[model samples]
Target: AALIVCVLVLELIVRQFPAFVIELTVWGLHKEIENKEVNVADKEAEAKHQQHLARFCRK
Candidate 1:
């Protein structure tokens, strides 16, 4: 599915540049929260980012 590809791409980015990806993810989440535009898809992506961040951090 498209969603799986998106997640895989994000995971690859995270693996290559974890710090940058984490910063961007945190900024995006903060902006979404501040604007109260937290849609289901946004939440799902945020969750995926967090999951990937955690996985990478354990390395």
Candidate 2:
């Protein structure tokens, strides 16, 4: 009975393993996309500042 119980537990874990992996993968992708968005925003701000500096120098 102990062996059967162990086997059942193992089987359950194996079944759920794929779902766990998928969740991790989704989380990682979400973080990556968020980082990309932040990077883009930073670049845009930098560009705006550069434009402002250019206008200032034109005076």
Report how far off residue 2 is in candidate 2 (Å). 26
Q: For every model in order, what is the number of clashing pairs?
A: 0, 0
Tell me the TM-score of model 1. 0.36
- Winner by TM-score: 2
Local distance difference test, each candidate: 0.88, 0.96
TM per candidate:
0.36, 0.60
lDDT of 1 by residue, 11-56 (tens): 8887879788789999999998876765866888999999999999
- Name the candidate that leads on lDDT: 2
State the displacement of the C-alpha of residue 27, model 2, in Å, after optimal TM-score superposition: 0.5
- The local distance difference test score of model 2 is 0.96
lDDT by residue for model 2 (1-59), tens: 99999999999878999997899999999999999999999999999999999999999
